[model samples]
Target: CLSSQHTEGNVGTKSEEKLIELIPLIISCSREKHIWKHIYVFLTPGLKWHSAGVVRPTLTVLPPSKEEDKQSSATVVCLATGGFPSNWKLGWTVGGTSTSSGVSTSLEVLGTDGRYSWSSTLSLSADQWRKAGSVSCEASLSGQSPVTQTLDPDHCSE
Candidate 1:
C-alpha cells in the first residue's frame, strides 16, 4: 500500500516557506509488513507556488557600435540575464519575422547568484538594417511567456 500527504510550513522567516510531501510505502512478506517513508521538499518564498524557483530573464537590445556604422554590415546584441535553470533560449526576429541568418548565440553562463546569463548577436547588411523595421530579441522558457525587447533602427542614435 502507498499513501501520500502534503504539508506547508514557514522556514527561516515569515517571508519564506517550504512545501513538503510525505509518501509512505508499505511492503508485505511472509505475513510481515514494513513501512518506509519518503520526503520531498520544495522551497518557496512568500508562500507563492507560481513560478517558485523560476526567474524570468531580463532582456536588453544594444544598438550597433560606431565602428559598425561605418562598415557594410552592422551587428546588434541581445543580452538576457538573471534567469534560473540555464535552459532559456534566445532568438531574434526582424520585422516581426523569425530569422536565423547571421545570428550567433552564446552558451548560458552561470552567475554568482545561481542564475544564468546569455547573449545573441545579429548581423545585418547596412541596407537591410535601415529597412529592418523593428528588431526584437526574445528569451523563452518552456511553458512560460517569452520576454522580448524590441528596437527600432530608425529611432536609434548613430
Candidate 2:
C-alpha cells in the first residue's frame, strides 16, 4: 500500500526564508482575492464560513437481536457521522437492490465539532434478514463519492 504525509507550514512568518515560500501566495491572494469573491458570490450567498475539508462519513449498522426478530421482522439502524455540509444522502440496499419501503430517515444533526450526523432505519422481514445475503448502508454527498458499510445476514446470530 502507498501512503502519503502532510506537513503544516506557518502562514504568518517573520523570517525571510519563510516569507520567501509565501511570497507567491501573498501576491496572488492580493490580486485574485477580489476575482474569487466575485466568482463565488452567488455560490456562497449569505454564508459566513465554509468548510474546505471533505469529511467522509463513518457508518455503523445495528443488527436486530434474536428476540426482536421473533416478531417476524428486524429493525436495522444505520448511523452516519462526522460528515460536513449537512447535505448527505443515506440509503439501504439488500443484495445490491435499493429499497425505500419500511425505511425511516432522520434529519441531520449538527455536532459541537461542526460536523454532521444522521441515521436511518430499515425494517426487514425475518426471512430477508436470514437470507444469508448482504445488507449495505450507503452515504453520499453532492459532488463527492459515496461511502458504504455492509453487514452479512449470515454473521448475525442470536
Candidate 2, overall lDDT?
Answer: 0.69
RMSD of each: 10.3, 11.7
lDDT per residue for candidate 2 within 67-122, as digits (tens), equals 87888988889999988657789999987899888899999986655567999999
Instruction: Write down the TM-score of every candidate.
Output: 0.68, 0.68
What TM-score does structure 2 among the candidates reach?
0.68
RMSD of 2: 11.7
Local accuracy by lDDT, each model: 0.74, 0.69
lDDT for each residue of candidate 1 in 1-158, tens digit (9 for 90 to 100): 43334333432333333332222323233344464433222323344322224589999999887778788788999999998657889999998999999999999875545567999999998878889999999998887799999999999987
